[model samples]
Target: MKNFFKIIIIAAFGVMLYPLFDSFSGNGQLNDLASFYAQKENVEKVNSANLVTAVVVTYRGLDTLGEVTILFLTAAIIAFFLTKQSEVRTLRRNSEIFQTAARLLIPVIIMVGVYIFINGHLSPGGGFQGGAVIASAVILMLLAFPNMPFNSKLFGLIESTSGLVFVGIAFLGVLIGTGFLDNAILPLGTFGELLSAGTIPIIYSFVGLKVGAELSNIISGLQSVQADN
Candidate 1:
């Protein structure tokens, strides 16, 4: 009976997606709307050399915010579940060589993560990717030093402050610019420069910090559960 229901669901999903596949143009040509967005004049409006970044941070800012919120909620839920459990499990320590390597590589990973988010508007990387990189560094630390002290309060503070700043910037756009999450809240500056792309760099910075902290908090919470067991 369960297999029957699963097959039905799969069939339904395939049926729903069929029209989208059918609508694809056979000719290898860009759609009119896509071509317009790709045009140099349209691309220059956001002052971002990366068109994908311009579309994400400027054109579809709210949608990106929704994605961030979803990630934050997932981390929060993981923390909550870990807290509810009373049993603690001990984690095995890594070898000395592994620990030493982690200690050496963590700083470099963090620096790369920061660079990725900071230059999001000018390059291909952005806050989400950078935040994941930062979180991976924290994961490595957790693995190398099982008993390493993690300050939950500090992580929470960082996450909260960064999220507040992101939202505040969005509201500021309402006050001074055309709409919420408007990149025009700050000066566009020279294209391709470090200081370019108006609020995009600032927004991505806060987002990267917030995501990194949230993920770290989740990992720490899970580690605490293991420690208690």
Candidate 2:
């Protein structure tokens, strides 16, 4: 009887959502607007090597900021769930071969991650993607070596500082422009150059730092929970 009601409710909700989904179209004004933005004149401004990244970080910066906030919130929720456990479980100590391999590979992984982040304004990868990669590498280390304890305080500090810095940078943009996130004040450099994307690269780096710290903290918190349980 309970299962029957749940199925009915889900079906009703799906019926309610169908119209909204059907009404959404990839045609008309939205298509025209997108095409306008994709023109060569605009594309050549931010080096145009990574046109999509420019679109995301500069053309739609506010949306990107909101996305970063969502990631941060997700990390917070994961931390909340994991931090409640009292006895954290430790990884067994017998993976010497795996640990050695991870230790050897960590530096290369970090280098690639940093390269991805630095080139984000001029390439396909961005801060968020690079940050996730770095976090995953750290997680690998955590899994390989059980003796090293993660410093939660440091993680929290980095996350908070990076988030504050991001806001501060955005505020600077506001001070120079009409709104809080306006990038009008920053100087747009020459195209195809390393430092040409105005404030987008800086903002992306800050976002990457904040995201990396938050994700690592979440994973560490989960490990603690496992140890506790």
**Highest lDDT scorer:** 1
TM-score of each: 0.85, 0.79
lDDT of 1: 0.87
C-alpha lDDT (0 to 100) for residue 197 of candidate 1: 84
lDDT of 2 by residue, 1-229 (tens): 9999999999999999999999987655546667776777766544435767777766777788788788878887887776645554554575678878998998888777777887887877888888888898888878787558688789889888888887887788778765665544567677778787677777778777777888888888776666433
- For residue 8, what is the lDDT in candidate 1? 100
In model 2, the Cα lDDT at residue 80 comes to: 71
C-alpha displacement of 110 in model 2, angstroms?
1.5
Candidate 1 has a TM-score of 0.85
